[model samples]
Target: MKARLMWIAGSLIVIALLGYGGLSYALRQNPHAVLDTVDRIAGPSGSVEQVAEASTGPHRQQRLLVYRSDDAAEALPVLVFFHGGSWAHGDPQHYGFVARSFAEEGFVVVLGGYRLGDEGRYPAMLEDTAAVVGWVHANIAKYGGDPERIFLGGHSAGAYNVAQVALERHWLEEEGVPESALRGVIGLAGPYDFYPYDSASTKAAFGSAGAGAESQPVNHARAGAPPMLLVHGEADTLVKPRNSRALAKALNEAGGRADTLFLPEGDHNAPLLSLANPWRRDPLVHDRILAFMREAAKVSVPVQPQTP
Candidate 1:
């Protein structure tokens, strides 16, 4: 009987060790992990630079990577990007492939990080976004970009943040950035409305949307807002496609150029990934974005400005 007991205890110890190892692995797979993975996939071909941290606190540092095309010197339009991971999870590095691909397509790309989760909320995200925009405007020329042709965009939670920052106006205006500074807004699989504060994280970030949940992008649509290009996956279970639909309809009614492209049978993950792999034969999300930027920036043909 003692021998049997010893065997059982030894099995339990092994199980405990396995459990601990699994937990550690999960913990390591945070937002930063995604960034690291993208960097691995994209390699070191591009010039990477550390740009700024969240201006409000020491929680995060932003970075920008430039992948120079042959014609990078001319005043190329810029795409300021925000990566998404439910507001608490993603980093700019997670979307580095997208940034590098765009940079290679004759545009400058700015990727930035923002304070996540409880460390920052609501106006804080707005402030960080405004600060990044200000940084881009004031310093993009050093990296071969045009401040006048800045396109603000993000994916998923990042998309919602961008929409809020662009529509709210107070954040940017307070930062001394005029509303006209942005040429357009691009949102990918973002939750522009439907804030459910039932979850602890949502409550901490957006407050109790409760009765006032309607005050999201859908409700705040007004004229003079920059044009919006919304790309959503119809099968996205995490964030419904209706969120994009609602925002697009409102923007159109408000006399803004708002267009929604529904990906046929595409889920949230593939659309953004497809941008970097055109051979995926998926409708080119990147091409759509380029077309939108060209129209918005009024650059009928590729124009490379002189490098400083």
Candidate 2:
């Protein structure tokens, strides 16, 4: 009987090892699908609930999900992270691992889906970003999150969306939401200065929408903007590391609090991968983001009481 039990334990260990090897090999080629499967197999690290219905038409992100652990006794900081698919693809449902990871770390994490594809277009993407921010500020407390302690972040095209929505006042204004609601912003391997619309994804998302206009986030740097942590990989060729440097430089020149973290040999997906479980090759990226969020959360945005 003891020998049989030992055999069973040994078999389990070998299976776990094989699964790990297969997952690591597949992650290089298909990160999103692998993450989605991981979430499915292990289940989310915390409780997850859908808070809104998906919008009809190009508004993929009209719907969103919230993740939280059950032991919270007080309001925690909020983190709203969007996925990147060149503004043309990606679903937040597939990225539950991201939401759950931060949720486990004591944040009421929000993973929102935004509109994608040509039908969604340029302004529509930014518009959904504003809507999601507005929604979080207005209704996060019911889920044990402090609305004032809101941190916005994303990867790739999703990073572009949050940067523009936080930097450009007009989008939030159009939604009747105050920009001060945002405490800090985080972007990973984002494109802030790709102006020519040369890439297929950019051309499809913004070509006819407004190709020649100054829609780049680097163009909107100004004083009094929320604190920003722009993280990138020095070896990133997809969006170019210079995009992050240029925007950070612009923000610094404008007297805003903008800092950067560039991995010497990092690639485009490396920053995001650091936030994942069992595969975090770059923990500094994750640690730096948490530090920024904790510091920024202490300073509340001043807002006047609403008049009756």
Judging by TM-score against the true structure, name the best candidate: 2
At residue 148, candidate 2 shows an lDDT of 71
Q: Which candidate number would show the highest lDDT if scored against the true structure?
A: 2
Question: Distance (Å) between predicted and true CA of 138, model 1?
Answer: 1.3
Indicate the residue-level lDDT of 22 in model 2: 74
CA RMSD per model (angstroms): 11.5, 6.7
Residue-wise C-alpha lDDT for candidate 1, range 156-245, written one tens digit per residue: 877887898888778677777777668888899988877555556567677732335643777788877888889988898777789888
Estimate, for each residue in 1-308, the C-alpha lDDT of model 2 and write its tens digit: 65345445544643584677975676666677676555434432344444443342344456678778777546999999989988877888777767766776778888877778865688888878888877777788888888777889999999999999889888877766676667988999999998888988888888878655468999999988887899999899998989988888888888786788888888998888777644443468778888778877887542221110
lDDT to native, each model: 0.68, 0.77
For each candidate in turn, the TM-score is 0.77, 0.84
Name the regions of candidate 1 deviating beyond 4 angstroms: 1-57, 61-71, 196-200, 208-215, 278-283, 299-308
